[model samples]
Target: MSASETTSRRQVGWGIVLMLGASVCYALMGVSVKIAGRDLPLLTLLLGRSAMLVVASFLLLKFRGSPARPGNPRLILGRSATGFVAMGFYYYAITQIPLANAVTLQFMSPLFVAFFSAKLLGERVGTTLLLCIVLAGIGATLVVAPDLSTFGGDSLFALAAAVLAGVAYVMVRELRKTDTPETIVFNFAVFSLVFSSPAVFLLDRVPTPVEFAALVGTGLFAFGGQILMTYSYRLLEVAFASVFSYSTVLFSALFGFVALGEQPTLLAALGAALIVGTGVIVSVAERVPPAP
Candidate 1:
């Protein structure tokens, strides 16, 4: 009835659409990683990704006239270090496991965030939060059931990526108080590039044109997804917008099926549902106001 209400609804609509687009971009990025990894070493792929991110993030900071240096160097470096290692684990998982399975396991970040936030941020974790964490743990186990018998499986890498990603996110929460997102991203990109550049000397062969394109696509799609997801949060509440992020799991499954001819087993499908459902509950619960 009111103009404000009408505008609010429209913004939410746009936010959902943008978030869905972001999910698709992320899924495509995973597919691209799989394609590129087939021909290149993991370190080579990381080098290419870091280079693209450095270029893209540098240009974005310049366009926004943001500072290149971080306000809190120690925290920024910690976040960047964790993020870089997590990315390496995630990329390795993508090459070794099914795309959907890898994405599902990595999505466990939010559950790990709960644990880290309680310990590091002094945030209280209630009964529901604890229960959600247990459910998510079980869900993750189911997703990786097939590989559990193998020591040091790729699924473990995905789970490790999730844990480190959670730590990086918690650090980002602290960094948000002092630095802009653009500055944080630029710093991380630079950190990744500087640390990963050594891989260039280790490369055994140059990538073919098709492999090169896939490597480039990995960064382009990931950056696009990050930009779109960030803007969507501006339009919608973080809790509501985050639900749309689970769509990335669905998109990854679809892309894996179509692009890579991969399919999820029945148990993995059930596990993915549990993880996505618990993730949505945890995200929404965190945003709810405490009872009076």
Candidate 2:
């Protein structure tokens, strides 16, 4: 292979690894949310998580000597606004639905990313890539099997979260053109903290010691996941990188089972299998240069 092609393959390889690492962190964050959701108000949980990110991102930028300001303030603000709202919907859905189900629903963001990346970023969406998206979508649907009566309002919130997340991911790709990952993350955390602060007064109960740990864990894990995801998306084509996001659904299923004592139905298990299988295919296929 040519040198550029070889470098592209390597980037794709590391992107897949980083995206999977992100999935693990995100899944763990969900576990923390599940544990703390009982006592924490939606806004309150967000407040703690955002606050943690603010501190973590600041330290990271300072340690690296990276600029804290985003290169494109407009794009950063738009990204943060969409992400903040998506998170609100996500927290509400997670509280109301099974953790795995809520995550699977939000997994729809990859489909949105694929389309938006193609339309907005002008990224290549060849036949193979489109098939990967379709396969992943099928897997996600099987995992969630969402129905009107069963999921109700939570389903609506989940869908809204997915749409908003889609927009946010597109903004990430856009920002990557001119901004460092730390800048994007720090700005997002700043916006989240500002937007979520007003909801702190809605706290239902003060958290116990264990609950406090869970709250902190949510922020820590989420920050790690966001950092990994930012780098992964920056390194790979948005469409290709997004296909690996299906890994989050698999991890969410595993965490939901162990932490929440939720058993996956046979169909859901099959769905998870489909998700993992497609992820492998996409990862391997991406290494090969597209026929010119």
Candidate 3:
């Protein structure tokens, strides 16, 4: 093998490592959100998380010598808006439902992403993609079915989060044409902070020391995960990196079981398998060249 091929393999190996670390960070973030949400209001949690992100994003931009302003304000705002709303629903779902269930449901964003890209981006939806979507739908239904009896509309909140996340991701794909990742993240942080600030004033409650730590952990973990995942994609193909992204669901399941004593029912576990497995198939399939 050529030296270049050896270097390429090394890069891919490191990328996988970074992606796995990001997944763990994200799973821990979910765990922190679950813990903090037990004592804090959703808005309050959002406010705290957004506030930290704003500060962190600003520092990152400064460190990178990048401008804080977005190159395309319209797309930035759209992505941020959708992401903010999706985050709200996701956090709420984490509090109301099992951590793995909420994570798996939100992980359905890829299925929705495929649909939205075809509709909004004028991308083609091939037969393989359609099959993956159908299987993912069944998986999501199974995950939601078990939660419905106890959590009521909470499970739907996760699904809403997934839908909005799909829109936000599509917007991000478009925004990448003009904006730097730092700029996009900085804009999102500022947007989330400005919009979620109302929660701080509206919900006047003091957090205990434990809750405060958990709130801080939520932002820290999320920021770390975002940065790691972004860097991983820089080293590897998006499709390849995204397959490891599904590892977040597994980490969430393990963390949920260990930290929260939350165990998925047999059906939910099966659903998670379907979603994760179908997601892997879709990611790999998207990257494969069509046979002539």
Candidate 4:
């Protein structure tokens, strides 16, 4: 009858579907942030988002009054550390790289997820998932294919984001055993505030009405997505949840075209198709027997 127990009892298919919906909403958050324009620095946006998330967490606790604290403050603190590192990298990378390239590379987090799941979660890795990994790498390559001519620095930023995001996600995967979504997200906001303290002086300008809205959206969307994702893990294995996450790519691409006018080339499109196909396969891949 506990929240964790309720989560664990939900059907895997439904959990995944919910996560997918969360992913789609997350992608739209990007679009909304874009609409707010470059006048709002990424750190400022992150800072505002952090404040909103912490408030949201407190409200959730006050409203339910359930025995919701995950009982391990240390675990929550650790997740906060990972969020600090991951969001720092992600916010920086997105600023440096083309949206498409950054998102493509970010998807590579699934590879790290699968590998970590096998080593940390003791899940058996299979050939199907392995191929999926290869395919996702190829897709990421395609996103940066344009840079092959000029060898842009965006690739570096994008890849760094990808790596750090994976590390943060592994932290999330670990935290799930001890913390609830509310705790994890609450910690994220706390860390964001702590991390942004040094840069507070730079935010001398008052955030525009639009910028404020975007920051609020970032908190709400990101928190909601995290909640759905937490519920998702309770239903299925890590790798499945990770791969299902790539649905964000499609929405990202669409948003890029519509909002930022960053159009993808035919090659990029082809590569994304392959990557998406691979992601789907990996998400649904069967757990193969161990090498006998």
Candidate 5:
């Protein structure tokens, strides 16, 4: 095989490993938060998590000596805004929805990313990839559809969270086009901290030693998840990396069952499969070059 082909295969291998590790750790974060909820209020725990992320990301950046790249300040600020909002929904959604379900819907963000990319970045959408998106959306809807009736109040919030995450994912595509990963992550933590501070002031109580430990545990898992995610993105195409990313849902489902006693139904399993399958197809299809 040519060098390029060899590199592509290696990238895929790395992507698989990174996605699996990241996904499992991310699922654990969800489970941890659920456990922490037993004693702490949602807002209080969220603020604590945000604070931890800020500290962890800052130390990470400092350790690596990551310097911010010069870019459009407007775009950076926009991303920073959305990033904070996205995490708001993310934390809230997990609290409301089953861990597996919330995570599965979030993974569908790449479909929105590709769609937005075509609109915002003017990237061409091949027919195959378009179909893949449709399939993925259908799968995601299927997974969450049953909860619509029983989960009325939560349904809207989860949908909103999923949509917000999609927007954040799309924005990241643009941000990465002009910035480094460390820069993006660093700014994400900064803005998340800034945005969460007010809520922290109003909602947070000083955590006990055990409560403090739970916060640290969740933050560490999230930090590892982010690191694995960033490393996967660096190793593989985001499109390709997205396929492996579905592994997060798989992991989350397991964690939900263990942590929250939210066992998967047959339909939910099937839905997860279809959604993740569609994502894989989208990734591989996007790999194909357009016909001249």
Candidate 6:
């Protein structure tokens, strides 16, 4: 392979590693939100999380010497608007549903990303990618096993969150044309604060000391995950990066089992296996040359 090819492969490898770390960070955010207790309103938790994102984003900007303003303001705002709404619904679902189930539902965003990237970015979704996505969808369906018996508002919210998140991620892929990761995150933080603030006014009850700390932890993990994910997308295709995001579902299952005392059903466990298998398939597919 040529030197440029070698460097590109190396960057892609590192991007995958960063995204895996981001998956872990994001999974842990759910644990923190769960621990923060149900008394904290969704918007209030978002307020705290966005506040920390603001602080972390600004510090990152200063450290990197990147400008605070996004080069493409309209795209950044659209990304932020979608992200803010997605996260609001995601947080609400997290508080009401089992962590693993909630995550699996939202994890459907990857399929949407693949679809939209093909349509909007003109990124090719080959036969292999299509098959992998189909397998992943089957796995996700097994994990959720959605039925009237188990379905509720939380499920609806999680699905909405996934769609919005998919849109936001595609916007991120586009914005990376001109925006730094930190600037993208800063704009997201600003818009999250602006959009979630009004709901905070209706929320009652201050967080206890432990709840307060967990809330802060949510933001810290969120910032780390957001920045890592943003950079990962910059290095790799959105659809490709999204394949690795399945790791978040695995991490969420583990966290739910350990922290929340939620045990996965046998079917869910098998589904998790398929999810992991798809990640492995995606990794291998990237490295292997196509048949002549």
Top model by lDDT, which number? Answer: 2
Q: Give the TM-score of candidate 1.
A: 0.78
Give the Å shift of residue 151 in candidate 3.
5.5
lDDT of 3: 0.76
| Tens-digit lDDT track of model 5 for 1-292 | 8987767766666666886798888788877776676667666666677777778877877788877553656777787677567666666777776665667666666666666666776656667666766676666556656564555566456566656665665566566657665677767767766766675556546777876787787877877886677666556544445555656666776677776677677776786788677756655556642111
Writing each residue's lDDT as its tens digit, candidate 4 over 1-292 gives 8875444444655766876887776676666555543676767767766777778877775665623455667766666776576666665556665666566666677778788778877766677767776676776567558745543665565566666666666666666667666666666677778887665787777877877787788777777776676666656666666766776766777778887887777877877787678756654555432111
Q: What C-alpha RMSD separates each model from the true structure?
A: 4.4, 2.4, 4.1, 4.8, 3.5, 2.9
TM per candidate comes to 0.78, 0.94, 0.80, 0.82, 0.82, 0.93
For model 3, what is the error of residue 160's alpha carbon versus the real structure, in angstroms, after optimal superposition?
1.1
Select the stronger candidate by TM-score from 3 and 6: 6
Q: Model 2 TM-score?
A: 0.94
**Candidates 2 and 5: which is better by lDDT?**
2
lDDT of 5: 0.66
Against the unseen true structure, what C-alpha lDDT does each candidate score?
Answer: 0.75, 0.85, 0.76, 0.67, 0.66, 0.84
Name the TM-score of candidate 5.
0.82
Clashing pairs in 4: none
**Error in Å for residue 36 of model 1:** 0.5
Count of clashes, each model: 0, 0, 0, 0, 0, 0
Count: clashes, candidate 2? 0
Worst 10 residues of 3 by lDDT: 283-292
lDDT per residue for candidate 3 within 1-292, as digits (tens), equals 8986667667766777887898899899999999999978898888888888888978999999988878899889988899999999999999998777788778777667777766886656677657766776676557546555565578899889988987886776666567776888889888888888888677666789999999999988877886776566566544344446666776776787788887666776786698678766854554432111
